[model samples]
Target: MLQETRLIMGMPITICIAEGGAGARSMAEAFGYFDAVDRRFSTYKADSEISAMNAGRLCRDAISAEMREVLALAEKTRVDSDGYFDIRRPDGSLDPSGIVKGWAVRNAADLLREAGHRDFFVDAGGDIQADGVNEDGEEWRTGIRNPFAEDEIIGAVRLSNRGIATSGNYARGRHIYNPRQPGDELDDIVSMTIIGADVLEADRFATAACAMGADGIYFIEETAGLEGLMVNAAGISTQTSGFGAFEIQ
Candidate 1:
């Protein structure tokens, strides 16, 4: 097994590959994918396509194909989630951040798969995508940190050929907002973790659900191929019917 962690996209990008044939080369290529995504879509960098668009220097029709794809996906999530998942801020500026992080991570994982690696894990911050079993011959288990207890692991989820993303206001501090309630802050829910078919799906819904506060769990339960666990400000935990399936024993 080979494991590597590098600071990229303003966060630690950690990757683990099992049965690595050409370890260094494979990991380098994987990281390259992430770097490319960062260069193109990052909101922090002034030269990024996203930043340029926000600055009014780039028009929608002139944007790159990849940017168009991400925006479309963001719109779809907004409509599907009843405007809970939105990239457009209250200031009316476009921001595709809610969709890009998971999309980039998922694409990076795909790069590893195309290179003939099956058992691998890619984690960008808290979002994760894992294929095949772990080095222990079991599904990869990802921890769900307790919102109240910073150092404690309240629970964990086992994922294989799937993805998990946890969105919380505690860490980001009002980073994820609700378009439906533009000015108001979402304070009812502290944490929301989603399990989905892939990283993009999981991450988008997790952000949207977290923005919905306590009502996020109900939306998650009604959605197909998505399960969520929500922790309220009072520390009450609520989950969808299928959420327990991913929880590690």
Candidate 2:
């Protein structure tokens, strides 16, 4: 097995291949893709495409195809989630921070699959995309961390060619926006984990659910091919009926 972590796009991106070191080159190329993604998408960087657009230096029509696609996807999420998944920052600038990690991770995962890598995982922060089995010949296990307690796991998910994403204050503080109040802090929910058909959709919905407060679980329940768990500030939990199907238990 070959596994490594690299800091990219302002997060620890861990890539694991269930093969020998011969997969190292592909993994390196995967990281290179991540690097390029960061250079283009990082909102904090003054030269990034997002920053350029926010600074009014880059025209929206002149943006790269990937940037356009990401923004388009963000807009779709905003619509699908009824504006809860919007990327408009407090400063009134576009910030696709919500879904870029999953998007980029999905891209890397696709690289592995295209290269005939059957068993691999690309994890960007808590958003994960994995396929096939691990070294143990079992599904990849993703622990959903406790929001109120560091290093404590509240649950574990068994992913088989699926994607999982957890959104909480622990990873990025209250970075998630409550679009209804615009600039108001998220108070109703402390954390939310979403398991979906793919990481891109999962992460976007997770962000939207975080903004939806405890009611987000209902949103996931109603959505097709998605299941979710939401924990409120008081530690009360709720989840879709099928969510337990992904549990590692």
Candidate 3:
């Protein structure tokens, strides 16, 4: 097994390959992709493409291919979530941080797969894209951290060829807000975890659901191919009907 962790995109990204065939070069390639993504999409950097676009230095017609793809996905998520998932800030500036991490993680995973490495895990911050088995030869067990207790894990979910993401203000502190009510803080729901077919799907919905507050779990319940667990401010936990199927005993 080969594992590496690096700080990229203002977060720690870990990539673990549970096989021997893929060497250090494969891992370097994956991490390099993440570095390129950060340079292109990071809003915190003055020279990033996103920053240039926001500053009016770059026009939409002149944006790169990756920028176009991220924008399209952001628009799709906004429409799918009824404008709950949006990248546009109250000031009309764009910040695609909510979706970029997961998108980058998924792309990194694809890069590894293209190199013929199947059993691997890619985690960008809290969003994860896991395929095949872990080093123990069992399904990847991803834990959901307790919102009230940062050091404690509430539970673990078994994932194989799937993605899981958690969205909450506990760690980041009031980073997500309802697009409809920009000023209203999403204080009702402290945490929301979504599992989907891919990291991008899981991440986009998790952000949207967190913005929905207590009603987010219901949205996950109604959405097909997605299972979610929601923890409210009172520390009460709620989950979808199929969530149990993915939970690790």
All candidates' TM-scores?
0.90, 0.90, 0.92
In terms of TM-score, the best-performing candidate is: 3
- The TM-score measured for candidate 3 stands at 0.92
lDDT of 3 by residue, 1-249 (tens): 998899987788999999955557888998999999989998999999999999999988999999999999999999989899999999999999899988998999999899998788999988999999988899998999887666899999999999999998454335443355444443478889999999999999999999887889999999999999998755679999999999987
**Better candidate by TM-score, 1 or 3:** 3
Clashing residue pairs found in predicted model 3: none
Candidate 2 regions exceeding 4 Å error are 170-187
lDDT, candidate 1, at 217: 91
Off by over 4 Å in 3: 171-187
- How many residue pairs clash (N, CA or C atoms closer than 3 angstroms) in each of the candidate models, in the order given? 0, 0, 0
Error of 1 at 24 (Å): 2.5
